[model samples]
Target: MALRMADTPTPVRHHRRSRRSRRAVLATLASVVTALVAALLAWPGAEPADAAPSTFAHPGVTVSRGQLDFTREKVNAGAQPWKGAHDQMMGSKYASLSRTPKPRAVVECGSYSDPNYGCTDEREDAIAAYTTALAWYITRDDRYAKKSIELMDAWSGTIKDHTNSNAPLQTGWAGSSWPRAAEIIKHTYTGTWGNSGRFATMLRNVYLPEIINGSNSNGNWELSMMEAAIGISVFIEDKGSYDKAMAKFRTRTAAYVYLASDGELPKTVPSQNLDTRAKIVKYWQGQGTFTTGLTQETCRDFTHTGYGLSAISHVAETSRIQGEDLYKTDVGERLRQGLGFQARYELGEAPPGSLCGGSVHRGLGPVTEVGYNALHSRLGHAMSNTQKLTEKNRPAGSNNLFVAWETLTHADNPS
Candidate 1:
């Protein structure tokens, strides 16, 4: 479903319990369990050789530190007062906007309303929760942990009664918020739920189950897969959860790939028209440009095709990590072929006006210059050891691909 943009008034009362008692319980439990689990998990015999030393510390710890320092500095810098009459009228909404709600299962949308919009998702709340929890994990700051636990409690509570199949019952409508929670839980508590068990139970019992059981249309499946993929990564430390998650992931991934290729996206876009085709073309061009412009003939003008690439990327990465031979399957081959399309298009080798009813656009300048920098950066670094590529030549966009070619030329090497 499309996100409805509106400036909704904040609700004064939420269903979550007060933070005091919740924090005391979660804090005590987290302290004891985290220490024991950390010792067990990081014991010399438990870890693989390549595990990052800090991975043993906790998930999202560094990100939390960065966010907290940034937020604290922002707050200390000063708060600006409203300058307009309308701003005064909207007083409390502006102030309470930053407060994190307690975790709950079924979020109430109608309670918050204003002239501009009806309701909004609490993405910021989830972000705050994860960041605060992570900070607590690193610094053992009771305030941060308490705040995080409060947010988690609110989220869990909201989602408990959510049964909506047409829309996400929680904020960040897609799988966004839950992943952050999972990261916080994994890192802060060393993979054990401790006081966070209620939050984990909410995710496992409510949020994730709904997403998994939902339809495959509108990239919902892919979004679900992303959540599952990240969730699997975070929880892989827990063998039982990891195994069950992997099985679910395999099923979901297969379904997502199938629906994406068999024409599910065109149905999902708001209007099935030429504009939709253009958007699809731009999206594919963006993907191709990111991959150095390798062409895939089969994917020309496939609507919302980037969703498929994203799904494939998640699956491939997960499979690689699990030491599965992804190349053995037809699905794997198709994914590789799609990646080729992305590469060829990025390199300006894809035939001009060949797709989208001869209206598809080309040139990496538009797609890669602004959109594909991070993608190129990650791929370029990952491929460096296997391929004779240098960081300077592998900048963040299509220009980097050009630099790479120039480097290869000067070195008398063909890329």
Candidate 2:
């Protein structure tokens, strides 16, 4: 994956008006009649006789095929241990974990802390493929495209054998896996790259139905529902599917949200919490680190259903996309509050020994510290009110370089 570019101050475009000219205009427009005349004068070219389709277009930048190919190679090689275990499990061809009796989902929680544990579930495999494919799409690299196709094929086949329908298992492993897969599929379709339609068909026809039907009654029902929503959203790509999935996600997410007593997430953050936060922070770390350092499993929490900052962020973003001003909603306000707590805790700005007070983990301090700064800057760019946040979290030195680069590349890009 391409890393985020270094920041180079983008030249500011300024329009200057003389103070005297402004005063003269104000004086001239003091009267009601004058003001009306001024409004008419300033009005953009009188409404067109017949409004025409907008001709506005965005500039297209060329993608780097070499970079994409290199990144795909690294992901494939690096994910080998996880892939090997997945393959071994699939080779057994057990109908379900209940039948074959694989390791419990909780066993893999340690994987979040240990790099060697490897990820379980078909979703991670699909995500690895999806990211590779995205890189290929952007770069137009045949190597990446080929590898992506291969990975997808393998994942699809493995998943098909595990579930009788499309629904996933309730195991903690599947909790992480399904969402990652769904996100990958969603991005692939939106990006207009690869066999997104065919991929969706496979998921809907084979993977999802089984997982959903099987796990529907379990406590993991919400997890399955959440992933299903994401997958259905990608597959249907219509208002109906979008509405249905959105409704379902909202309904199921209530449980987790309710777990937040008085709208505050518990402070005894689990290992999963750290892992999820680490990846969420890494997302803004820039493209290079994102492509090389973060994996699909690592980033799953950002898009999944759970009681974490990542989940809250996803809900906020999803609501915004749906044209709902989440900032005005109770959940949105709660998320803001939670993020405020995180910021205070991470920065050592909170009261000593307070619930929201804790030292940043040594392993994650560097990346998250930089991430906090970048995230605040991006947020500040969108809302002037967040300027203080940007300043408060601003990273120093080399870390600042990534934030600058991201600003140049994505300054005008909206979430």
Best by lDDT: 1
Please provide, for model 2 over 1-415, each residue's C-alpha lDDT reduced to its tens digit, 9 standing for 90 to 100.
2234333333333223344445555565566566566664333211111111122111100112232233334345645322332233223322122221122112222322232222333434433443344444444555545555555544444443332222233222333233333343343333433554565565565545443422223222443444444334433343444444444444333322322342222111121232343543333221112211121222222222122333333434433433444444444444444344333333434333322122222111112221222234334323222233334433211121010111111112223
Cα lDDT, all candidates:
0.38, 0.33
Per-prediction count of colliding residue pairs?
37, 24
TM-score for each candidate, following the candidate numbering: 0.43, 0.42
Estimate the TM-score for candidate 2.
Answer: 0.42
RMSD of each: 21.0, 20.0
> Model 1: residues >4 Å from true position, as ranges?
1-98, 102-105, 108-122, 133-146, 163-165, 168-176, 186-194, 218-226, 229-308, 311-351, 359-415
Per-residue C-alpha lDDT of model 1 across residues 207-319, encoded as one tens digit per residue: 45554433434342434344453443343334444344344444333333322333423212222232454554443343222122222222343323443444444444334
| Residue 304 CA displacement from its true place in model 2, Å | 11
Candidate 2's C-alpha runs over 4 A off are 1-123, 161-198, 206-228, 238-244, 251-307, 322-328, 348-412
The best candidate in terms of TM-score:
1
lDDT of 2 at 156: 42
